[model samples]
Target chain A: MSVSARPEVRPAERAEPAGTAPQPDTWRTRLRRDWPLLVMGLPMVITVTAFWWLPTLGNVIAFQDYNPYSGGIFGSPILGFTNFQLLFSDPQFIRAVTNTLGITAFQLVFYFPVPIALALLLNSIMSPRLRALVQGVVYLPHFFSWVLVVAIFQQMLGGAGLLAQTLRQHGYQGIDVMTNSDTFLLLVTSQTVWKDAGWGSIIFLAALSTIDPNLYEASAVDGAGRWRRMWHITLPGLRPVIVLLLILRLGDALNIGFEQFMLQRYAVGSQVSEVFDTFAYFSGLKTGDLAYGAAAGLFKGLVGLVLIVAANRVAHALGERGVYSKS
Target chain B: MSTTDTVIPAPGRGGPRRGKRGRAPWEEPGSLAGRLGKGGVIAVVLLLVIFPLYAILLTSLSDSRTVNAAGGLVLVPDGISFDAYRQIFSDTVVSRAIMVSTGVTLFGTLFSVALSVLGAYSLSRPGSFLHKPMLFSVLLMFVFFPGIIPTYLLVSSLGMKDTYLSLILPSAISAFNVVVLRAFFMNIPRELLDSARIDGAGEFRILWRIVLPLSKAVTAVVALFYAVGYWNAWFNAMLYIDDSAKWPLALILREYVVNAASLPAGTAGVAGYGHSVPPTLAIKMAIVMVAVLPALLIYPFVQRHFTKGVIIGAIKG
Candidate 1:
């Protein structure tokens, strides 16, 4: 069961009883009571207005033939869905879409279970100190930037890196794991695992530790082997977290990240490396085609929104606490 | 289990007894072979994770002469040289970048914490005006990320381009951090607040005297999260800052280490330093270390609070 941390606030319940609610004096008293709280909220209100709301309003350009020469949103000519139509018609955009989904799918297949495996392995070790040390070591790479991670992989396995040098010394051929277009999926996914698997296991380990010890003890007394105990008790205990994270992951299927690809795109060539974020950056920001780029972004945002909401509903239907409760 | 079952407990009773080496009480005492096997797995995973660190350190320290001899990456440490650490510290470009990064992280974290703490506090009270709308707005940002182009346009148009504020403000407050902080704030017992209110304590007084002090652990965790974020930021610099001299350490490290490119001219000492400089390999690895090392040093201290606070606040909040 999830521990409730948020004050389950219901705005409707907080409203005053209907009828006989019209007085300047009443609002004044309410304002007097709430003005201090509102002061605390001032920075957030300003920030959200400037950053979130304004940028959201800037999405208007996506529907317009926006020009830098023109004064932004108001001055731009309307071109409803024209930019989106052009975006979809481009072969490069199609390539980006395919690459995005392809890499995301590969990560889901290969990288998703890594943390679960890690958490289970870690839980099996009875020594708390050992578990902590291993955890510290493995969780470390998560803090490293994607640039550093890609660099680390290149340093170890690139054409002129340690493995390649050692192979050359032993009279073998060069290694090109870092720059090879064919193995891009494997290399990137491994980097993802190396960077995130340990960190991801934190929640799973938290979940694992929460399982009642008596369950394990009872199962063991019932003549279950270690593997059988794990399959029956441990696995069941982790199901909620697994489902929760899976739903979240499905929601984020489009966000495969950008830095790794951007850093490596030169080495592997853009042919195999272009994803939506990079494509958006290249097409919009770098080339000064804000409207077209915004269209691509808007499309991605729409899909992501639908995906997350649907995924949350599915999680609720399956009796899992996905991200938020429906209330 | 390894105590030879000498206590001779009744059937169900023995399942909860002490076992050797702190094995689970219900576990069959692992055989010597089994323990060794477990240790071996841990060892291998540790080696795999740590091997890159060793390689980078060794390469950074290896005497410039022996580095090429030892195959691109220095596999073994031989006659450790401080040339790399010395060079980057001495170099103007890298050192300035380090200063820039420190400034951004310190200021950025402070700004982020202030905004998030205030916002979270404002949203924590259930019946406050605009509480639900504000909270839902924040939550909606998570589902529908503002597109990169529009965000860039907004920041640029607002005259944040090339400014340090650009580094700090565009991504100033994280939704996750806000949610976590709000969760922590909300968890403060309602009765405690009510009692404080009855004692004539205003919301601000209660927040400062009671809430802030009580929530130190979560506060530190959120602060560190923002600090690390600011330190690791390069994409913002790439997008907003045009002046090469304004580049932060992460951006510099990205250029020198990841892209394997030399710093552009006018950056610092690199342009004028003709020939006698140390090996580029050592310099690159040293930058990598510089980028990564601070987090390592600071991690252990914040780790306890970080794990506990983030798990409870983030997942549950």
Candidate 2:
């Protein structure tokens, strides 16, 4: 995604004389002038209102004793904090939250820096052809669906998989890492790294490209070693982007992805694999407890909002522009 | 070294301090040990990325006997046959799923791109009527998500539970893509748009003639993103679609390749209506290949635009 672009508001028709600003158009005049544009924007407005805003507002059902046939969202009896009270007391719900946060924190430490390290490695490659080849190969897995990635991992790591089959052939006991719930966190983390780490490196690679070649040359001419130059020049140049992405990651910490966990939940059992999204699905939708599940989801959303705001505040405290500016 | 061997030698040692293989003059080629270490790491990374894909491709093309000899997935290609491919192509479930996926991706991409373009262009101009609320709504979507159960209820309530529209509409509009498109449209020289307006062109005509032509790269990139999202989506199908006949290729891939592998004797149920035997290992690999092949085929064409497209959306958003 494009970074560091300020909104360039150069309204074509409104580029009047600098000193003398024209009077703002009357509402009637502006509406007459811009109706076609309004018409053009109507579909998106309706869509966002219907699918996004409406569903978000539908979270009111979280507080109600919601039943589809017996008094839907509007007709359901209000239960105040009853649904939430039940949610916090449920062991499965607590487990889902714990597993979700635990995975997010684990990935932040292990998976976050992988792409940065990869970008540095890629940047040091002297041959453009080799670098391009490596980039293309690494980026391929990112495009594969979660289902396909899971299947590939299964073929390599599961019982009767290549690893196990080869071991059995060699007269050793076979291993099945895919179904081991104890190491499910590590398994999912590795899968994520395999799938996304290379693609994630694109942003850092872009940041690296922006660093001037002259700085490297100047440092090298001063007799600085490669590692020293990286420490002094390269990493400092990457700091802003690094900080920016770190803040974004913190903001998005709650969402550890859905399809990945959902696909593996049955295999590993939901105890280890049930994150917030799957928890909501299984408990609320699958079990037909509409309000209770919605309560769980709403709670997650509100916490996410708090996390993002807090992360943005931290960014500002660190003197870097976070997601949104002070304005 | 090769250039020097060709006799186009430097005038003097002081002329230009060129290093080997077009390395910059100030750059060090590093010690032999360090070079080997870096080379080894790079080799492993490439192998980690490529080996799985290579094995999957080979196994899909191998005969049942060859796959059986390998015990699971074939790494070394001893023989090649298209029996697995033929088997999948003839299976109604797979063929129908492929058709469903293709239709959804095509229609979904078109619907998303059309709406996004119109929406982005309408909001491209600053100080337009109702622009603030519209833009605010789009931007707000980035921060807050309408949780899953609510979204599910909406779909069911709308009578779109079993329909393909459920797959497309819920995720049809991405705020980041709209922002990217809007950014690109705004970057287009106002002179072009103003000149067209001066020449009696309406806003639509101007957008069609001036803005769209200039913003084709961003639009194509946005369309690619939407198409890929539609193609790879399975969770939505799993949630909203209960009718097995309408399941997309991704869901089918998940069922036959992923979930089936974990089930005890799972392949027993995968054979065609009257067939007795389970699908071979070759057929499972083939299913995985079918899911992946489109992404591979389309990568080279769209690969170049990703940096421009994504970086724009990321920074702007």
Highest lDDT model number: 2
Model 2 residue A301 lDDT score = 93
Q: Which portions of model 2 miss their true places by more than 4 Å?
A: A1-22, B1-21, B261-279, B307-317
> Would you estimate the TM-scores of all the predictions?
0.90, 0.91
Which digits, one per residue and each the tens of the lDDT, describe model 2 over residues A103-132?
999999999999899989888887867887
Each prediction's fraction of true contacts recovered: 0.47, 0.56
**Best candidate, DockQ:** 2
lDDT of 1 by residue, B97-157 (tens): 9999999999999999999998889888866666666777676666777789999988888
Predicted structure 2: lDDT: 0.81
Which ranges of candidate 1 are over 4 A from the true structure? Answer: A1-27, B1-21, B31-33, B264-276, B307-317
Candidate 1 residue lDDT tens string, A1-327: 011222222232235455644443344444655777889978976787678778877888999999967566898889998999999999989998999999988888899999899988887876767777888898888788887888888888988788888899999998879889999999999998998888888777767766777887898999898889889998998998888787778878888888889889889988899998888888998788989999888888888889878887888798866556655
Candidate 1: TM-score, chain B only: 0.86
Tens digit per residue, CA lDDT, model 2, B183-289: 67777887677667757688788888888888776787788778888999999999999998999999988887887733223232354435323236778888888
Cα deviation at B36, candidate 2, in Å, is 1.7
DockQ of each: 0.32, 0.33
lDDT of each: 0.79, 0.81
Question: Candidate 1 lDDT (Cα, whole model)?
Answer: 0.79
